[model samples]
Target: MAMGIHKFSKRRGRGARAPMAEINVTPLVDVMLVLLVIFMVTAPLMKAGIPITLPDSRAKPLDQTPKQVTITMNAEGRVFLDDDELSPGELAERVGSLPRGADGAMPLVTLRADKALEYGRVVGVMGELNRAGITAISLVTVAGGAPAETAKKP
Candidate 1:
């Protein structure tokens, strides 16, 4: 009888251990890492710029600067500032209204125009920007024409 009671008490004691209160963070961390990777893969695709066929140029790309404004013109000769459509007058007004930097310098501007646009039309836009006191301008173009060395290689 004594032995039976002792065995029963031991079994009860074995089952009495407090249920594990600690959480396993390993699985949680793995799920978080997977979500982070998924976001990283899709984030860049979300920043799609306005569509336009830029002219070709061999000039090297400019170093992107901070506080820069992008101006885009589609094949229809419509002007867009940072993806928002604006009239010629509105463009000038909005650009001229931008706050100057600490050094009193206007923000750098990048212009991307469709190759199908007329020369005078593009120049007219440039003139508008120049009149707005935005001289620090960069033209966006795609790479065209193989380099002399690469052409000779064939």
Candidate 2:
């Protein structure tokens, strides 16, 4: 009887430990690390502009201008005005409706076309922009691999 009572008390004492008042931060930290890695892996894929391989150019980059408009053309000849897809006719109308700058001049247009597209298709888009009274146009291109000195030698 004495041994039974002692065993019962020992079991009770072992089970009566204080409830945990602190959270386990290890699991939380692990989860947060996983989420951070997922975001890092996906961040580059989340770029906002249209994905197209730009033509390479040796020309220097232009200075940043205020109130500039961007137009993108894909290899399929599809046109987009800042991510909104538009037909050729709709593109012209939308470009025409854009508000003029503070100086009463049309905003500078930046055109980005896929390197695989035909010259005629690019020209057609430019013609639309020109018709919309946008005279200041800049062609967007990726910097070429050739160094300045090497390019100058050609």
Candidate 3:
């Protein structure tokens, strides 16, 4: 009877496996996968969009997005054209090489400059865009809840 009875003695692997001495990562992996799917589903829904009433229209929807160019100026004064880096001196010539719209209109230029940048730097970039024959430039800014008092120069 003693021989028939088995025990997980102190000796390694003599009985039941040592309480897994390691973490059961299967549960952690499952949890992480669930969170990833949840975020993937909800991400687009979280986009900020303005609510507006649209007029009824029988016109067919436009086929393609409007042509526009994005120019970003980082805090370090680096310039990017739709993700391509450009030197300050190359702005005018490179911008001129960009294609115009199918209707022959200049593609709208969106200027994004870091707030900490000097005032003159931003203006200089705008001047380059103007010299490139881009006149429909739009300045992107953070939306304020209400109109604020004007800022004055010291």
Each model's lDDT comes to 0.84, 0.84, 0.72
For 40-122, candidate 2 gives per-residue lDDT tens digits of: 99996774478898877888887767788889998888999988999758878899999987788888899999989999999
Better of 1 and 2 by TM-score: 1
Q: Which stretches of candidate 3 lie over 4 Å from their true place?
A: 1-65, 145-148, 151-154
Cα RMSD, each candidate:
5.7, 6.4, 11.9
Best-to-worst lDDT order:
2, 1, 3
Steric clash pairs (candidate 3): 8-15
Encode model 3's per-residue lDDT on 1-154: one tens digit a residue. 3763455444565455546577789999999999999999999676323222222333343322468777878777888887788975999999999887778887778777776788899899999999999886766554433345579999
Q: Best-fitting candidate, measured by TM-score? A: 1
- Write the residue-wise lDDT of candidate 1 on 1-154 in tens digits: 6555555455554684447788899999999999999999999667447788777778887776788899899999999999799975788888999988999999889989998999999889998999898886788887664444444554
Q: In order, how many clashes per candidate?
A: 0, 0, 1
**Who is ahead in lDDT, 2 or 3?**
2
Residue 121, model 1, lDDT: 91
Least accurate 10 contiguous residues by lDDT in model 1: 145-154
Q: What is the lDDT of candidate 3?
A: 0.72
